[model samples]
Target: MTTESLAEPTMRVRPGWTVAVVLANVGVFAAWFGPIQVLLAKQSEALAPDNKEFVFGLVTGIGAAVSVVAAPIWGAVSDRTTSRFGRRMPWTLGGALGAAAGLLVLSGAQGVALMLVGWCLVQLFGNAVLAAQTATVPDRVPVEQRGVVGGWVAVAQVPGALVGTALATVFGGIAVGYIACAIFVVLSVLPYVARAQDARLVVAPAFVLRDFLRGFWISPRRYPDFGWAWLTRFLFNVGNSIGLLYLFYYLQDEVGVPDAGTSVLVLTAIYSVCTLVTAIAFGAWSDRLGRRKIFVVASGLVMAVAAVVLAFWPTWPGAVLGAIVLGIGFGVYLSVDFALITEVLPNAVDRAKDLGVINIANSLPQVIAPVIAAPIVKHLGGYPVLYLLSAVITALAGVLVGKVRSVK
Candidate 1:
């Protein structure tokens, strides 16, 4: 069916379609987070033991910078696509393949330059897949069901991270771990691409360079809800990124964990289980109650509490408790907030592009987090100060959610 028939997205998506989307996301997140959680740190340490933190931050920050540009451009391109297969399908398939190629490059990298190159490729293409997938929720799912569907999709993140970390840990070497992630990403995305009934753009929109450029600048004055939603998401992610970016080091340096990698896996497992439970349950509850703002506010506050726990306690038990609390908070926030954002999109014609712009909120934090975190860990009151800052930012994100007047 063409997009003209799906202008309002009233039809409820089938369970099979939901499952496919979830699996594809699982793969994408696995490939992305595996390196973030384990492989990259290990590689950086090997390349520059004394300066692993700097190298890790640089590589990830630059990679996130690439994603900042790639997602919206790819989304806009997909918005104008007129492929026989579908608008989103071609890009989704191409992105997964390109990301896999990037992973292959990473698997063989011997120097920092090559490593940087490989990671940038992964981010560039990975965002394409993410952009297309994110848009599909609004394109296909009905409003009433979005919370539950978004919850299911949101829950994929934890499992994906877990799977990736486990693979990286089980595989041992960096090359083997990267290769495993590459294979998993390709395999996971295939089912979605093969089965998806994406909207086909029969006639491409008229391309006006000036108009196209203007489209990117969504005026906050015209769309206050979108602007507020964007800002809140950005703040929450900033807090999250700062909290997580230095976890490997935190475990080793502060907690004094002997085997940091395995500890990360364990914490992730606890976090995953909690997230899986809350994401689906809270999402369904939001849908049932037809309220989005309350859940978002509550979750953000909960996350802030979790960060505070880690800030003060600084023990293995503290990390575990923090993970559980953070997972619950994140699960609820991720699913419900996604539903809220979809409700606030400025225009349906540019769903993918708008989501991509919103995604900048997600990626930009990664870029800035390193800049923010490195100094705090190095100079300030160390991890304690970092966590306190995270708490403050996260709590503010929750307070700001009340400004998104459109959804609730």
Candidate 2:
């Protein structure tokens, strides 16, 4: 199927909805990175400072495990939904509320068991919102606008991190910080759910148990482009998560920063600025030039190089430089990657389901990264080996993107 022959988008997603969705993404990041990060750190410090990596790994792994299952289920349901408020709205609202409830539980969590339950709830419901909201891109936006729309979503991450950090800092307590993030998440999602319109489907295929099960396995031989895209995203995200998710502990242990939390904000500030600038530029550039693979390959290579820098020089200065490079690479990848995915989907009628399968590549890595890194960080010295491993994984992602024949 050629890009030109694919159905034109039935509606153009408005700027208001786009902005609201972006803010919602920001809220998620704020919750995930800011308050959650601090909370976990405190827990790890209090419970097992010697095994900080292991504790953190376990927490993240639990959440990702839940997300892997929940995301696709929610996506498939959204596809078959025939509601008056539209397919995505109900799930969006439910996801936000569910996530908020989980956040409340996390705010008061006292033990590892409670922490595990709380984060699992967060991941399950948070992914519901993510799956539905992500579908909105291909659902409403025209092919021509996807790059810009993806860019806006991509650029929101940095600001969202900043907002999360500010909330955590201002609240000065994990419980209060979580409450603040929950409120922000609900508020961010409200405008889009309340005001933005989604088209009601007149009819959809009836859900079949066997068909639904089969949908999970899209043959790589039949849809090679989609297969390649999924592989590239999975590998790149795994590499990125290894470098990203352990930063709090990394700064505290490896760099010897007295206040790793504050230092993280500083480095993130640099990374965010670079991501915002580069995302907007590269997003627009991809739209104008009408190319995807080259940008993806370039981003992967850049990230690999950044990982190398961190591996060689394990210092604050090295981290800052690495953050800048990683930001550029990730920013560009985030902008164009979704646009590319939309173009390669095998069945337009099942776009949400297919994208759900693709989304696994994202959520799966959260599980895989911690599982892989925990052993490495625990047994094989420290982060240096991990960073070198990150470089190798990301460079492999670049090479795989070159295998894709569609979307370029």
Q: What is the C-alpha lDDT of each candidate?
A: 0.91, 0.81
* lDDT by residue (tens digit), candidate 1, 157-251: 88999998988888789999999999998899889988988877788878999999888888999999999999999999999999999898999
For candidate 2, lDDT tens digit of each residue in 75-169?
Answer: 88888877878778898888889888888888888777888888888888887788787787787788888998977875676787878777766
What lDDT score is found at residue 324 in candidate 2?
A: 93
Show model 1 residue runs off by greater than 4 Å. Answer: 1-6
The C-alpha stretches of model 2 lying farther than 4 A from their native spots are 1-7, 10-12
Flag clash pairs in model 2.
none
Q: How many Å off is the CA of 320 in candidate 1?
A: 0.5
- Can you give the lDDT of residue 359 in candidate 2? 82
